[model samples]
Target: MPTEAAFSWPREFVWGVSTSSYQIEGAVAEDGRAPSIWDTRCRMAGKIANGDSGDVACDHYHRYPQDVALMRELGIGAYRFSVAWPRVLPRGRGQVNEKGLDFYDRLIDAVLAAGIEPWLCLYHWDLPQALDDLGGWTNRDCAGWYADYAALIARRFGDRVQRWATFNEFSVFTLFGYAIDWSAPGVTDRDAHLRAIHHVNLAHGLGVGVLRDLLPQASIGAIHNRQVVWPEQDCDADRAAAALLDEHWNRAFPDPQLLGHYPPQIAAAIEPYVRGGDMATICRRLDWFGLNHYGPIFAKADPQCTWNFAWGEAPADAPRSALGWPTWPAAFRDELIDLSRRYRLPIYVTENGAGGSDSVGADGAVDDPARVAYLRDYTGALREALQAGADVRGYFVWSLLDNFEWGSGYGPRFGLVHVDYTTQQRTPKTSFGWYRAFIRDARG
Candidate 1:
């Protein structure tokens, strides 16, 4: 790793933290906020671990001023947070919730007043439950509904917020929710799975157009979660399986948006939904690329699997986060280099962090040396890519505080600051001090 005296980064490089609405803001039924698919999912028996829900998360909705103060103290240049879809449109369409909009307006102002730039994400898997009642993402009209919501928010706050992300991790929702029944609105149907992909692509492109027309000065992009996929065996069958998984997990989403067409492997499968002029609508030009990578995947051939590949289990000795995600720093650097070579857009490491089983000590310090080392190792690879001339403009840790971790509940913690879910107290972890000092020294 480079020392302080040997570091090289652009003067305007952004250091930030990312949080999704459903993951942190816990007021599920407050301020005219209608129920989201996640709320419904958490209520289903055997769906979540320990029967935990985001009903009271970190209570950030009621204590955002405190959260903003924490961000200001951390010395980050930006704060990326999502707008609750259900909060803004209680029924998903046809009516606006003024109270819901007021909440974000205040949140945005607080973030700006704290001297940090506000990066807005329009959707983060908290689809309004009412939309699920009407077919949700599988419905083709969802494209127009999302565009309408985008237009309303853009026309309201576009002047103050210059950066907007249309959606966050489309594959996680469609793959887990529609294909595997592991997430909200769970339905395991092959046809509905593919339909969700096409419709989300349409909604994103349409939302981009809406933002550009109403707020031409704004920067618009979508956050895509991608990683390298390696074959479990060197043989042709396993190689083909990994290729198929990569095509769907990695290339399928961005190819249509950036290259104006679907990958050849999936074109025939989704051709039924291809209408005239849809490609152009789905290929709207983005101002930048946002990547959310955890680690690479190893895939083995599996005929019974929906995608013809199954995630191979890691060896007993392999390094993993508390969440069991593999740790591969070299692959992280390669992802940056590959993305730079392929799309050549200004890149942002939008979501990168490791989850650990952290706890507050008797000394009142969260001495998570494991998490500190993880951040150091991962970011060392990031610096290597920067020196190799990747146009990386920003890097944001996966989160700011320990919040809800989806179906895993709150057991897996990925945060620079630790939050006591009971008392709602925020405690800065050891990594927080390391990052603050690193940014201070590097920016000097």
Candidate 2:
């Protein structure tokens, strides 16, 4: 364990919190916002936990000013949020929603007024249901549609927001949505999976080009969720599963986008979708690498699934968070160091935190000691990575408020502030104070 005195950061290091459009902003139908794939998925029976949907999630759509005030008081230097594709483009392409664009314009102005920089992420897995109707990322035309949407956002908010992320966690969405039935637009077909993989990479590269062209002064990057993968057992089958899972989960996105070639396991499989000059289009220059890591994952052979590998469990004795995710700060440390060496760009830990089942206590206080411990341990490892020469420039916690957590719905709380779903109240947890003080001391 590192002492508080040992954990120090440079003055230029950025500290922020991240939240997505679908996860936080409710008001799905208001302001001409059409249905997203997630909206459709939530309507399906037994898709989301407790049958909960994002219909009224935290009500951030109407209460963003209050959220910005909360962030100002927390003393963060930046706020990273996403724009809902369906909200901006309604049916995904032809028509523009001025009301939807106006909402973000207001939100961005409020954030800037509070003296906090805003990092705009274009996509966070909320594909317009209209696009999914046309086969979503499984079709190559989807990339061009995404680029047009990017141009609209750039022309509207480019002057105010200089920090841009093309997409967040590409592997997690493509893998879960296409290969497994765990996410929205769930389809378990190999061709669909391969097409999605190639088209998304193409979209990212196109989005990056658009941002660079429109916002010449902007800093651009794409967020990837990378974690070490381990086999559940010592057998050959488990090892093979772990290896393949690692390639898909870790190497699929960054390997192609940064290195200009797909991973060995996916190279031949995705070749059918590749055309002349496609590799060049998929490997645009990025200013930084955004990493959203929780911890290492364990893989086991599963003959029943489309990918043939299933999520395995950690040993019963390993340290874990309230959500049963393994708590290994060393893995976080190693990931930062390895990412720095591999990509050769400034790195930002865009999202790193734990999830817990927190409830407001009787005294009107949220005392989450586990969350504080998790942040402390992870940040300690982060400092170690810095000392070992990882070119890390920023660190943003997973979220600012506990909103919708995908298929798990609102069960896992990964927020520094606790949000009451009924009243839409925001209460800063004990970890919030810890982070505020930590940032103050480090930056001072």
The candidate scoring highest on TM-score is 2
lDDT of each: 0.90, 0.94
Quote each prediction's TM-score.
0.97, 0.98
Model 2 residue 5 distance off true place after TM-score fit, in angstroms: 4.6
- The deviation in Å at residue 66 for candidate 1 is 0.5
lDDT of 2 by residue, 47-98 (tens): 9999999999989999999999999999999999999999989999998999
On residues 1-444, what C-alpha lDDT tens digit does candidate 1 reach at each position? 456457777899999999999999999998889999999999999999899999999999999999999999999999999999899899999788999999999999999999999999999999999988999999999889899989988988997999999999888888889877789989878799899999999999999999989998898888999899988778898899888878878887888999899988889899998899999999998999999988888888987867767777655676887667888888999899889888878999999999988999999999878778878888888998887777889999988999899999999999899999999999999999998987886687
- Mark the regions of model 2 whose C-alpha exceeds 4 Å error after superposition: 1-7
Candidate 2 lDDT trough over 10 residues, lowest sum: 1-10
